[model samples]
Target: MSDFTREPFPDRIFEDLGGAFSMGCIGGFVTNFFKGMKYSSTKMEMLSSGMLFARRAAPSLGTSFALWGGTFSCFDCLMAKLRGKEDHWNAIFSGTATGGLLAIRGGLKTSLKSAMVGGILLTIIESVSIGINRKTIQTPRQQFKEYQRFVQMSENQDKKSRSELKLSEFK
Candidate 1:
C-alpha cells in the first residue's frame, strides 16, 4: 500500500520554491476573495471584485513566497555544507538569515526583529519535530537516548559560540 498521507520535504530549490509559490497563490486568492466580500455592495459586485482582487494579488503573493523559499533553500544548503551536517540548526539559521535579508529594505530594526522571530519559529518547529519523532519510532530506551542527545547538543551550543565551533562539532 502506498503511504501518501505525508509528503516528504523536497531536496531541490525549484521544488521548494514551486511548492511555496503554489501555496501562496492559493492562500492569496482565497483570502482576498473573502476580504473583497466585506466591502462589496451587490452580489455581482462581490463576485467580480473578489475574483479581480484574487487575480491581481495571487501572482505577487506567489512571487514573494517563491523568493522566501528560494533563499531559505539556498541558505539551508550552505549551512549544511559549512556545518558538515543536516540538522535543525541549519533550518533555524536559514530561516533567520532569509528573514533578515528579505526585510533589509525596511531598515536595521525590522531586519533584526524579523531574524529573531524567524529563528524562534524554526526552533519551535524543530523541537516539535523531535518530539514527534520520539513518539513515532522508538523503544523507551532508544527514545530516552535520543532525548539525551538532543539535550546535550543544546547545552553544547550554549558553551561554544557559533563562529568558534568547528564543522566537526555538529557531528
Candidate 2:
C-alpha cells in the first residue's frame, strides 16, 4: 500500500498480467536497442567486454526499468479503476516491485528472441507471483497494523500497571 512496499498478490498479478504482453513488448524494444548497441562495439575485445558487461548489467538495468515502469503503469491502472491516488507518480511507484521482478527474471536470460519471450513471461508470471507473495508476506498495511497492535498492547499494559500501583498504595 505504501510506496515501494509489497502490495497484495492479487493486485500485482492482475495488474502485471493485464499489461504484461503490451508493456513487455515495449520493454523488449528498448532492451533490443541497447542490446544492438552493445553488439556494435567496434573493437573485438571491446565487444567481448561489452558483451560480458551487458550480460551482467542488462538484467539489472532492464529489470529496474521494467519494475519502475510496470509498477507505475499498474499503479496508475489501479488508481484509475479504484479512484484512489490518481496522481501520476504514485501510479508509477505502485508497479515498481512487479516490474523489477519481471525485468530480473526476463532480463537475466535475454537474447533478441529470448528477451521478447522472457519479457512477456516476466510480466505475466512475476506480477502474479509478486501479488501472491505480497498477500502472504509482510505488506505495508499489514506491518502498520501489527505495529499499531503492539503499540496499543504496550500502552494498555502501562495503564494496567499504573492502576495496580494505585490499588496497592490504597491497600
lDDT of 2 by residue, 1-171 (tens): 444554554566455554554465555555655675666747555555544555565555555555555555565566655755433334333444344444565565432444355445656655676688767899688899999999999999999999999999999
TM-score attained by model 2: 0.29
Measured on C-alpha atoms, candidate 2 has an lDDT of 0.58
Q: For candidate 1, which ten residues in a row score worst on lDDT?
A: 1-10
lDDT score for candidate 1 against the true structure: 0.84
lDDT of 1 by residue, 44-139 (tens): 799888888888898999899999998998898788768876777898999999989999999999999999988898889989987997779788
- Candidate 2: deviation at residue 121, Å? 29
Cα lDDT of all candidates, in order?
A: 0.84, 0.58
Give the residue spans of candidate 2 off by over 4 A: 1-44, 84-171
